[model samples]
Target chain A: MNKRILFAVIITVILCGLAQAKTTITWWQFWTDPNIKPVIEKMVTEFEQANPDIDIQLTDLTWANGHEKIVIAFGSKTGPDIVELGSDWIAEFAANNLLMDMSTQVASDSADYEGWGMATYDGKVFARPWILGTRVLFANRDLLTQAGYKENFIPLTFEQLNEATKKIQALSPSIYGWGSNAPEKHRLYKKFLPFFWSHGAKLFSDDGSMCLLASDSSIKALKVYKELHDSCGFVADQRGIEDAFLEGKIGFIISGDWLLKRIELENRKINLLSSFIPGTKLLGKSFQGGEFLAVNTASKHPREAMRFIQFITSPENQVKFCVANRSANPSSLEAQKDDYFSSSIHLQTFIRQIKFANHPPVDPDWVYIEQAIEEAVENALFRSGLVAHSLYEARKKIEKIKAQ
Target chain B: MKWSKAGALALALPWLLTFGIFWLFPIIYSFIIGFTDQQLLAADTQWVGFDNYRALLSDPDFLKSLKNTFIFVLGTIPLTTVIALGMALLIDKQFPGRGLFRSGFFLPSITSMVVIALIFTNLYQRGGYIALLSEMIGLSPPEHGFLYSGETALFSIMAMDVWMAVGYYMLIFLAGLKSIPRELYESAEINGAGKIRQFFSITLPLLKPVALFILVVNSIKSFQVFVEIFVMTKGKFETSTMVYFIYETGLTTKFEFGYASAAAYVLFVIIGVFALAQFLLFRRKQVAW
Candidate 1:
């Protein structure tokens, strides 16, 4: 009887020890949408099942307040092991040295994912890109045809777009040509920069020491944008503009992939078309932004966190996530060729635009620089018709930001 | 009834603790941080006494925000005070469904500002009801509607603020009106005073205290306008008020805590000055009356 009791005690001790051996890694993610939340949960559950020695704890975040929460968490040193960061926010955190250096860990697999420019800081990778997307010109083919254009009208050049919008505006007193963004900071820049870039306007010079916004190309681009705003543009916030488009009130709206999901969910029956942004020469360079995964410096379980990042960002898992998300594409190069993304025409347009899209300059001062660009756009749209003057002021502001 | 000092201290401890932790500490800490170069996420902070204040004095954005805040305060206060007073007078009359009218007027004040701002944003959109009404009246609205136009964005928000806030102040004026002695109006009527004359001589004078209180409170509230701008225009189209500027600098765009704190202190001073001036002006007018 004594020998049997001792054996039971030994087994209990071993079981307790084995349970304690499993490492728990906390992941803070921003996939709160009903459709995608389950996919994330399933993936995490599968990951834990596959790796018996690991446990995953997931926390949800919203796009509206996630950045502030993450900043406060890091400031207080209570951040989660793994965090999902917006592509633009990575540079700011990495510059502050708040992110763990994943250079050695991700070095081998870095080339597999796209948008590394946003995740790398000072020649070192700090985060892994997970999902990539870009803005596309969402048009109403019926509206174009009603305005006496071809049934499948898609503007190939800036002049064509301008004329198309004018013709569409002439269709009725209520109908509008374009859905232009109002002077909202952090957002208006995305709308204006595409026009500027398509005209070959580089934000900074080749050496990256001086502002190039005052160049001729930039002024020309601003003029095009100003004309759009003046002619038949239905100026409003992003949601308002998209709603107008969904209601078939506007001719064309430069919007993001999320609109596709919105259309599907709302079950809007309209003659819809998605195409590349109209450009001056080649196709316009739309804004590329995405989500990235990183291990916080405050994380106690860095190894486990890195492992989880790898598991979630694997090509197969990324494709599954993209399929669930319905709008965003997988960052994985291999996953980009998946049938799910290729099967949808709307996703195909976004994929092509993503290839041509340009991520804003990856710098610590990008937040401030983008504000300056936004102000310039606002000045051109509302304050004055002198696009050159607006560009000049923006260049001066950018110079000051760089100096600081 | 007398109480022991320890007992009293124990009773007050919860309030005192919360006050110190949430209010007093942040106030003092933010004031101190105003003189330093503290980034929200940066590990290190350095003292730069007077630099932030000096920079703000020359900052165009800061100046514009200050100007906008002042315009908001000045533009809304008189209009809101008169409209609320007029509303209170109408509601105070012995009329049918007076209680229903009072509740109807007070409903908007109780509603969330964010909800109202969002509703107003839609109402001010191009081809929205406002634009349609403008067309109906043959007074052509701006091409891009109200909120989207630089000329009308701030004014549109100001109009909404007044409409939402008038109800609360009207209730206050109603309370003030009820408190006035009925005997005084009886005496005025007996003296052969006309209704208009009695109102100006009796009601206006008696309502002085409430007016002063509302003016000071409204000035402070209007000067700190943020939610409407944040929701409607996002400080765009020259609608960046002082509070919105500080929020953008410290929390949203730049995360320059020190600069935002300095801007906040400046706003604090401005509000203090305005409040004091209103107090003095009201006191002198009371003496004249």
Candidate 2:
């Protein structure tokens, strides 16, 4: 009887503690490793220190499982207070009303966010950009020099890049000319989009109500991709594109600044020159992607949550997060001015070039469309030779989806 | 008196309620959702009748997924069974390092599926270790690692799955082996019957039930192969099984829950037919035994 009475008292005290505790905003992130969590936690800690009335609990998930879990959580209305969403996911979430409108918050002058306009949906920005990443050329200067190309004289146009790759291929049979991903990364769209832009094709017209992919401009983009692949004289196996680049088999590689994080570790001694993929001068474009930090609208403490997002996205914290984690070019204009740019001239070049980048449209179905386009293009270029038909078919599929 | 029916039902009540609310309700509701023509959120949804299912039957990707899923089940089951049976037979006898061998065989199963998939992706990588090994051994290594080519991607993933899952099913087979009433094997030995004959005559008849159980489970798992595809290929590699297509269509691309729900029912029917066949075949065998 005495023990039972003591146990009851202990349980009552625990319950009281739980009820009286500070409200914790549960946060979930797709980045699940020490590589990203430390800076995020430090930012959270500072916020918690500033606001003693609130607590932020963090959960981590791998990118593979991340989206599915978030969707399930959102469907069940058991979602976390905050979630880091990809640029494309914001459209679907906002369209479904699964995410809250932040335009009012921004209008209220309560939230100072730093994300690209792509994450905006119906005048409401759903995400705040954390890292600025875009696909560009990473040239192995040693390989280029051996092939008798000038060290700093990278191509300024797709035509020049082809000629340059031909020279590199002639230098060595064992080492390839250039490397890009297999069709599987669905990255063909990234490789091809700049060309599409240069050819005067818009994915959707000004109003986002029509498909321009089947247009002559898009066909011209297809021809450009075919020329690049064939003249590059190489293809990295699917998802193996990064590995191929890292193994030093290619003279030039087309991949992202995010990949540079992994690439620099391997070829620290091998001089790498990063340059913008020179367009055909009709339009200079790059496909921009980045992580974003946003306050959860459903959070019990939206004001506090907004404060945390602002603090983390601040220029000082951005530098800390970027440098500490070897992050891609920081999203903030101010953080791009840091000392890290001295050696990584390529990443700096991306920063200079990002001002000209029109982010790949934030259609909710972009990932799927990209995939179908990639497969169609790959089939047309590598397997069969139906470039025009492939573009048309892929665009038709996207149209059907958008129509629904 | 020890554990009353009322107490047992009370203990199970919470689980029943949970399944009823979260699992059963969602599944039933989804089947109903599949019949709707429009997006459930914001958009007006209406009865589409057989449109969703009809659309699935006509969709080339759905047909491709169905084919891939069947191919995956066919490829993995026999391979897993043979390997599992061999392991069960080998470990049934006491040998040096037998405990260590058993643990080593089971180790891959215990590693998180994502980790296992990553390790295999490297192993099966172009110019990776396996390629290097094959070249050294005077074998014709694939130009690129298997998954790069559409012909071998699904097979490559299926092979990795069999390697990971064989040990788990071997343990099941080992359990069945133990229950074979050792006297039967001893009698065959006394009659001077050879080991192979004894295996076919005595061991197989008894192991029929276990074999059917493993095959049915392997089919279901292989049909729903997602984690491996999710991690290694991300459904690239021609490895988009039914579950993977359902996953990407529902979540990765657009949230076309109606179409995805219909696809799930299609996969459900595929599995249902296979399960029924297994039940019929095994029921007769069980009676004969």
Regions of model 1 farther than 4 Å from truth: A1-15, B285-289
DockQ of each: 0.71, 0.21
lDDT of 1 at B61: 94
Candidate 2, what DockQ? Answer: 0.21
I-RMSD for candidate 1 = 1.5
**Tens-digit lDDT track for model 1 on A82-145?**
9999888888889988999999999898778888888889888999998987888988999899
> For candidate 1, lDDT tens digit of each residue in B177-248?
998888888999999999999899899999999999999999999999999999998888889999999998
For residues A55-123, write the lDDT of model 2, one tens digit per residue.
Answer: 888989677667777777776677787778877677767777767566665554323333557678777
- Please report the candidate that would top DockQ against the real structure: 1
